[model samples]
Target: MSTLDQSRYLATPIPGPRSQELIDRKAAAVSRGIGNTMPVYAARAFGGIVEDVDGNRLIDLGSGIAVTTIGNSSPRVVDAVRRQAAEFTHTCFMITPYEGYVAVAEHLNRLTPGTGEKRSALFNSGSEAVENAIKIARSYTGKSAVVSFDHAYHGRTNLTMALTAKSMPYKHGFGPFAPEIYRAPLSYPFRDGEFGKEIATDGALAAKRALTVIDKQVGADNLAAVLIEPIQGEGGFIVPADGFLPALQGWCRDNNVVFIADEVQTGFARTGAMFACEHEGIEPDLIVTAKGIADGLPLSAVTGRAEIMDAPHVSGLGGTYGGNPIACAAALATIETIEADGLVERAREIETLMKDRLGRLQAEDDRIGDVRGRGAMIAMEFVKPGTLEPDAELTRALCAGCHAAGVIVLSCGTFGNVVRFLPPLTISDDLLVEGLDVLELVLKDL
Candidate 1:
């Protein structure tokens, strides 16, 4: 197997004969509940392109749902994983510890927001990290009620499903969720009434309104933690108005409620900063991270204040495969790559290019209700022209068009009318522009 070409090439149809064969096999072997955005099967991926089994190169704008920030098959991550695998794959940190796992924890402790004494616990996925964070919060605060915002997506587990707000695929039939999880209003600037007109001016007020709701509904004295995405990921890439985070954090501090920043998708320099909370100068009490943490490895972590993290009893936080040596090695290398290669700065460059291209598209298309996000995590919400009514049908058509034309884009939003762009930070300017060109053409056709 050779590295994929870092440019678009369609040797066959979108889901060519080979991919169709694989898709057929998958349908027979895999569960119908597993959703696939694109029918093509990937052979290999590098930089910003995914080469399908049929030899079609598609520009990857989704970046495996923001997991491949450094890029697919990153040399540093690949080398680290190979070397660690040869040495040792797993020791199950709980039973027998490894240097790599400790090193990764140390790195996360120092890197995540807040200069205070911090500690970390690793997990295999974002949902696990979030669940652990909640557990720690409850243990420390001695409270059971937790608050999550509307349109927020923590994970798919039973507890996180209760934290999540979207209904259809995530929480349609999975009813009778965990108890004591409450929902609060989020400061969605694009959709919020009146505040959308002057976000900067009304942000504080919006924050106060949300806080008021939480105070009234979920009493401040009864809350363990207020979990939120610094910049919401699955909820259409919604960026809260300025002053909103600060106000919420302040309220949490005053009321002794832990503020947990779910940086799973927005961490690891995806938002031009190492963590999204850094952009607002807010230091969360606890931070949940995953996605880009180990480039492409299965890793997640909850890093927080020392006292709170230490509140859990001995053997309370360890998992069999939580901090596997291989994944830890990849995380160490991924962090080093981010710092040495200056991928944080690269994310800002990608943002500039995206804003320039998508801004022009938004100007041309009235259906583009809003264009928002930071760094490489950008999105455009679709709606009826000159109206706020969501146009999910158009959003789906545009994504399908991009897929057929050898570009991979993802859709989100509570109303299912958001098209998000999360290209790898390592994507070349030419490749990024080319992908955006395909998106522009698709929008125009729609």
Candidate 2:
């Protein structure tokens, strides 16, 4: 619906009658376990705007948590899905293979951060890719221990819950988690206090600190892999210290522990590069990618060194609908659109625009503890005006205010005091600034 107006419009109050009715239905029919960030219900989305069921055109700063980098219902992706579904929806790649799956794999193998021979296996979601990556790492290294960092957000599965660091919603009572998953300290420049300044300059110090713990607690011989998000998503868009990643990769290489970059949130040009690892010039032995891979389709891949990826035996690394033909076609079109539209560079432009605006806001607002992140994945951590103590109240208030004003924003951070922005790369500069304007007004009112 290119003819559809792609700008913000408010036809009714936030969560008007229709939306509230739907919400009532959802409350009765849906599981309470699934949480919602907004009271508004999406009816249609295009470009930078999500038209809610109440006909309120809200600016989409969350991009479905960076899933719609190419924008919601992208033309190329839609066309590809339509063609693929008409021909064949699913035949189960493992049972009866198809070229779309192979093409998608080739694209991932070539796009993911790395050089030399690489292999790829697709899955339905980020959790599946991560679980399989762990399986492959263990198969290759013959180790049982995996190193996950603090402020990390992996997924919801049992094994991923063990790999993830947050409690409360993610891990609270979901205990008895998978064994052998160890947690390490991350190079959080904003929250590390004294070490924050040190790590900013020499991130290796932070890396060394975590490495020492791993070496002492979980010996290198027993370590299968070190999993981390280059630029964490749900865990507050925390970008690790500059040299921190290289040091970790080096140690993993030295100790023969597989280095896996969980780029699920930072992949596919979301971080101004094809992958966030490129910013550090670090080529992870294995990289897990999803989210923005196929526009908005469910697709994920674990692409890595050929030797490591091929370690698993036949039929050991796939799912029934892992590389469904429809998803693969969408992925191919998504890549083509990314390349043809130059969305990678567009992500860089969005970065410059957002950081410039938010940098000005942060300078005047002491409550904004820190402003950090790369590309469209930027975040502002909120804290007490004069101290480092997190201000979760203000964070929640700001998000609520934005939502009421028809701007879709999301919050994160271990303390729930970070407001993150993940607007689609296709958003026009005017629409983005309008969204930011709402945020500024909301913050001031708060």
Q: How much lDDT does each candidate structure score?
A: 0.92, 0.92
- Per-prediction TM-score: 0.98, 0.99
- Candidate 2 weakest lDDT stretch, 10 residues: 193-202
Instruction: Count backbone overlaps in model 1.
Output: 0
The sequence of per-residue lDDT tens digits that candidate 2 reaches over residues 102-154 is: 99989888888787899999999999999999999999998999999998999
Q: Give the clashing residue pairs of candidate 2, or none.
A: none
Residues 1-446 of candidate 1: C-alpha lDDT, one tens digit per residue:
23567889999987999999999999999999998999999989998999998989999999999999999988988999999999988778888788888898899999998999999999999999999999999999999999999999999999999999998899999889999999988889888854456653476787888888998998998999999999998899999888999999999999999999999999999999999999989999999999999988999999999999999999888789998888899999999999999999999998998988888888988999899999999999999998989999999999999999999999999999999999999999999999888888888887
Q: What is the lDDT for 50 in model 1?
A: 93
| Candidate 1, pairs of clashing residues | none
> Relative to the unseen true structure, what is the C-alpha lDDT of residue 31 in candidate 1, on a scale of 0 to 100?
97
Cα error, candidate 2, residue 41 (Å): 1.3
